[model samples]
Target: MDDLIVKVVVRLAGVYENHGERVYLDAGHRALLGIARAVQDEAERRAGVGGNKVEGPVIKFPLDRAWREKKDRDDA
Candidate 1:
């Protein structure tokens, strides 16, 4: 839909305006990133793809696994 495209463009423009040319590399732009995610979900829904559907292989990892592993190594 035209509106979805417009929303994407507007959100992208906001990212560029706030973070210069390479917006994707800016990890600290949480508000802009959230807006971009919402726009993506909206566009996906409009295209008949469920907004929550995963498009790729899922990788599961424990959040504190790396920290615990490092601590074990240090203790050893």
Candidate 2:
């Protein structure tokens, strides 16, 4: 999985445009958020916020619960 992500980063970096960097950064941020969300404990998640003054909760559900909710919502 880490290798796959590294490959994606390399591919994104190869693109010769400013927008490619923006997209790559967005993907990186999402990856970090996913990692943070996977960790248990609200305090840990909050710590992951790292002094950023975000208005709401930093992380959502774990991957499984998030997928299940998404599937349920889609089925409905």
Candidate 3:
């Protein structure tokens, strides 16, 4: 396993041993929340806000192609 993953597992085990199951679960929950928040923040940074734009690669989703094709069909 990766070093970071190993460290997190060790830390969580220590938490469970010292605090109990509730604290360990809370720690894991909080870590997941942090990861989700970071992803949202990064997405907003890349997508920009208001009329202001940022210099970054555009992220295209699979649904984007379907939408474009639908729009083209409608226009034709």
Tens-digit lDDT track of model 1 for 1-76: 9998787678767877888776634633754666687688779878989647665655334469889999999999
User: Which stretches in model 2 have alpha-carbon errors above 4 Å?
Assistant: 1-19, 41-76
**Tens digits of lDDT, candidate 2, 1-76:** 9998898667657652556767777767876776675553456556775443446666443479788899999999
- Model 3 stretches astray by more than 4 angstroms: 50-76
| Residue-pair clash count for candidate 2 | 0
Model 3 TM-score is 0.59
**Candidate 2 clashes between residue pairs 3 or more apart in a chain or in different chains:** none
Clashes of each: 0, 0, 0
Q: What would the per-residue lDDT of candidate 3 be over residues 1-76, giving only the tens digit for each residue?
A: 5998999889999999999999999999977876786677677777874442435755433468789899999999
- Cα distance off (Å), candidate 3, residue 66: 50
User: lDDT for each of the candidates?
Assistant: 0.70, 0.66, 0.78
Best by lDDT: 3
Task: Report the C-alpha displacement of residue 26, candidate 1, in angstroms.
Answer: 8.3
- TM-scores vs. true structure, each candidate: 0.34, 0.33, 0.59
Ranking by lDDT: 3, 1, 2
